[model samples]
Target: MSSRIPITLAGLAIVLSTASALYSAHALREQQQLVDHLNGQVARIQPYAFSRSDLDALLSRQSLAVAPPAAPEAPPAPMKRESAPIVGERRYGDATAQFSLIEYSDFECPYCKQYFAVPKAVVDSSRGNASVVFKHVPIHGEASRREAFAAECAAAQGGNDAFYRMAGAIFSSTAGNGTGTEKPLAVIASSIGLDGAALSRCIDNQEPLQKVKADFREAVELGIKETPTTIVRHNPSNRQVVLSGAKGPEDILRAMAKLVQGNGAAQ
Candidate 1:
C-alpha cells in the first residue's frame, strides 16, 4: 500500500469515532430528562402536536377528576344491538337505546383502561336511552391477542356477561401499555365463575383469534389507528362523533349532548 493510504484510513477512523461519541452523548442527555424524552418522541412521530407540558397538564387534570367505580357484580351489558347486527360483539345497555358508543379498544392499552368508565356512566344515566359496544383491537402483541381471546372464551362459556366480566377484570388489573399473562387470565375467569378448564381449553385452541381479528379489520377500515377510539352516535339522525385518548366523563357527555341537541334543532 502507499504511505498516504495508512494516514487516510487513520483519519477516517478518528472521524467515525468522534461522531459515534457525540451521538452517545446526545442520546444520554436526552434519556436523562424524562420530559425531554417525551417531547422529542412526540415531536418526531406523534400527530397529537401537543408538547410534553400539554400532556402532563392533561394527566394532572385527569388525576384531579375523580372517577366512580363500576358495579361489583354487573354482567357484561349486551352487544350488536343496532339495526346492523354484529354476531359476536360484547355490549352493555339497551339494544334499542337511542344513543350508542362504540369503543375500539386493546386489552393491553392503558389509555383504554383509563377511559373505560366514562361512557358506562353515560349509558347508565341515559335511563335505557344509551348503550356501549366493545370491540377487540389487540394492538400490543401475542399477549394482547391472548387476553382478547380469553374474553371471547369467557363469552363462549357464559355469553356476553362473561365476556364483559373478563374484560373488566383485565382492564382493572392492567398495569400499563404491556402484555398480559396466563395466570391473571385464569384468575379473572375463575373469579368470574367461568369454568377454568374450559377457558384454558378455549384459549389453547385460539379459535377466538379470528373473531378478534374481524373487529380489528373493521377498525382499520374505519381509520381508527388508536386505542379507545370512541364513536358516539346520535342514532336518530345517524350522526357520529369521535373521541380518542382518556377523555373525561364531562367532556364526553357534553359532546354527546351537543350532538343530540344540534340534531334535534336541525330536525
Candidate 2:
C-alpha cells in the first residue's frame, strides 16, 4: 500500500508539470499573434507620415506663395507754354521796339509791388530796344480784381498813359496783401489826375471788367501761375524767355540780351 501510494504521488506530480507547460505554450502563441497584428498596423500607416524636414519645406513653400504690396505713384509735372503771350494795347516804351516784356502782374502781391518799376526801368534803359506789355493776373480776390478794372477804366477814359499812371498809383498807394489803399478808389483816381466821377461811372457800369477778364484769361492761357512773371519776347523772331518771380532790371536786361544774341539780330 505504501508503494502504491508513492507511485500515485509521482504520477500526479508529472501530470501537473505537463499541464503547466501546455498553458505556458498557449499564452506565448497568443502574445506572438498580438505583436504581429500591431506590426501590420504600423506598416499600413508608415506611407502617410511626414518627417520634420518635409513639414518645414511645406511651410516654407506656403510662405513663399503670398505676394507683397504695391508701391504708390508720383505727382504730375507743371504745364509749359506752347506759344508766346499776346502784347495788347496796354504797352510801355516804343511800340516798334524789337523786344516786348510781357509782364503778368497782381496788384495786391508784395512781390509784384517790388518788381513794379523793374519792367519800366528795363524799357527806359533799353533806349527803344525793349518794351513792356502789362497784363492782369489779379489772383488776390475782389480787391485786386477791382483795381485791375480801375486800371482798365483809366485806359478807357484817358488812353494807355492813364492806364500806366493808375497802375503805378495803385502799386504805390496799396498797403498790399489785398488791403488796398487807405483812400477810396475814386480818390486815388483823382490824385492821379483822372476824373474821379468818370472812373466811378466806368467801374459801376462794369465796362472795363471785360478787358480785365480778357487779360486774366490770356494770363491763364499763357500758363502764368504767380505774380511778376515776365515773358521776354523778340517780336521779329517770336522767340521768348520766361522770367519767373521778382526779377531785377539787370536780370531782365540780361535775359533780353540772351534772346537778342540767340536771334543774332541787331539790338
Candidate 3:
C-alpha cells in the first residue's frame, strides 16, 4: 500500500507541472497576440493621422458640440420657446436665413474652445446663406457664469460684434482655467475695443442676467449637462435637429445636407 501511495503522488505532481507549463505558454501567446494586434492598429492609424487643426476641422464637421446632461430635466418653459432671444443676446448673420444653428456653450469648456473656429468658418462659408444663433448656458464654474453675463452685457451694449468679439476672444485664446479668472470675459470685451463702461454696466445690471438665467434654465430642460449643445433649426418648417457632443465637422456637414434633402423631399 505504501509503495502504491508514492507512485500516485509522483503521478499527480507530474500532471500538475504539465498543466502549469501549458497555462503559462498559453498566456504568453495571448499577450503576444494582443501586442501584435495593437501594434498593427497603431501602424494603420499612424499614416492617416492629421494635425490638430486638421483634426479639429474634421471633428468640427461631425456636429458633436455637447453632450446631454446625465440627469435631464424639463425646462421651466418650452425649451424651443422659453429661451427665445431677448434684446441682449448674441446673434450672427441674417434674421431671415433659411436655417439657424443654435449653440449652447460654456466658455470654459476646452471642447467649446475647439469648436469656436468651426462656427466662424461655417459663418464665413455661408456668406449670407445661413445664420448662427448664440446662447450662453454657462455650465462650468463661476467664471463661466461671469463670462456669460459679460457676453450678454456686450451684446446688449455693443451688439453682435461685441458679443462675437468677446466670445471669440475668450474661446480663441487657450488662456483660462475654465474659470473666468484666467481670461476674464470683461478683458475679452476690452480686447475687442468695446466700451468698458458699458460692458461693466451690462455685467452689473440684472436684465441681461435674467435673460442668461432663463437660457440656463432652458438648457437644463433640454437635458444639456455638457459644454456645447447645438440645435439646428430649419426655419421654413420649424424642424429641429438636436446634436449633442463634441463631434466632427464632417458629421455636421452631412447632417445639414441630409436635413436639407429631407426637407426638400417633404416640400
Candidate 4:
C-alpha cells in the first residue's frame, strides 16, 4: 500500500509541472505580441516627428524677411456740384424735411420705370416743402435723345406736370428694345398729348438736346456709371450719399435716414 502511494504522488507532481509549462508558453507569446504592437506604433509616429533641420528648411523656403503690405488708403470723396436743379421743381419746407433724394435716370431704362412711384411719394409727402429734382440721362439710344428733348418740350408747353407724365410714359414703353427700331418719338409725343406737329418741328431742336447733353456731362463728372443711382442729400453739413443700382424705396429711405441723422435733421 505504501509503495503505491509514492507512485501516485509522483504522477500528480508531473501533471502539475506540465500545466505550468503550457501556461508559461502562452504568457511568453502574449508578451511578444505586445512588444510587436508597440514597435509598430513607434514606427507610425516616426514620420510625423520633424527635426531641427526640417524646421530650418521650412523657414528658409518661406524667407520670413518680407515687409507687410501698406494699409489701403480710403478713396477720395466725390465732389459735389453747385449747379442748378437740372430739371423738375424745388419746393419750400425743404430744410425741415426728412430727406433730399436725387434720381439719375434714363428715360429708356426699365429700372427707371420701376421707381416712378418713389419720386411722386417723396414730393407728395413733402407737400411743396422738400425738393425732388429729375435729371435726364439719355442712355437708351438715338430715340432716347429725342424723347428726352420731347419731355422738356412738353414742359415748355404745359409745365412740370405734363413733363413728368410724359417722362413716365416713355420709360414704361417697350419701344427701345434694341431691335433697331421703336415707336417713333413723334408717336410717343402725340400719345402724351403734345402737339404732334410741334413735336416734329422740335424733334431735332438743340435746346432740349443741349439740356440732356449737359446732364450727361455732369453725370460723367460725378462718376455716375450706372442708371437709377439715387443720391440723397439729407443735410447741408453732411456729405451727400450716393446709392448705386436700381435700389427700392426702403433702401433709399434707410440711406436718407442715415444722412438726416448725420446732418442733425429729424428722423
Candidate 2 C-alpha lDDT tens digits along 170-200: 9988877778777778899999898887777
- What TM-score should be assigned to candidate 4? 0.57
Per-residue lDDT over 204-234 for candidate 1, one digit per residue giving the tens place of the 0 to 100 score = 6665766776787777678776677788787
Candidates ranked, most accurate by lDDT first: 2, 1, 3, 4
Total residue pair clashes for candidate 4:
1
TM-scores of the candidates are 0.64, 0.65, 0.62, 0.57
Across 211-230, the per-residue lDDT of candidate 3 in tens digits comes to 77767776766766555667
For all candidates in order, the CA lDDT equals: 0.68, 0.71, 0.61, 0.57
lDDT of 4: 0.57
Give one digit per residue, the lDDT tens place, for model 4 in 123-181.
45444423566776666555556667777776766677677777766766654422212
Error of 1 at 39 (Å): 36
Candidate 1: residue 230 lDDT (0-100): 83
RMSD for each of the candidates = 21.9, 42.5, 21.3, 32.3
Which candidate achieves the best lDDT against the true structure?
2
The candidate 2 region of ten consecutive residues with least summed lDDT is: 51-60
Q: Where does candidate 1 have its weakest 10-residue lDDT segment?
A: 56-65
Worst 10-residue stretch by lDDT in candidate 3?
48-57
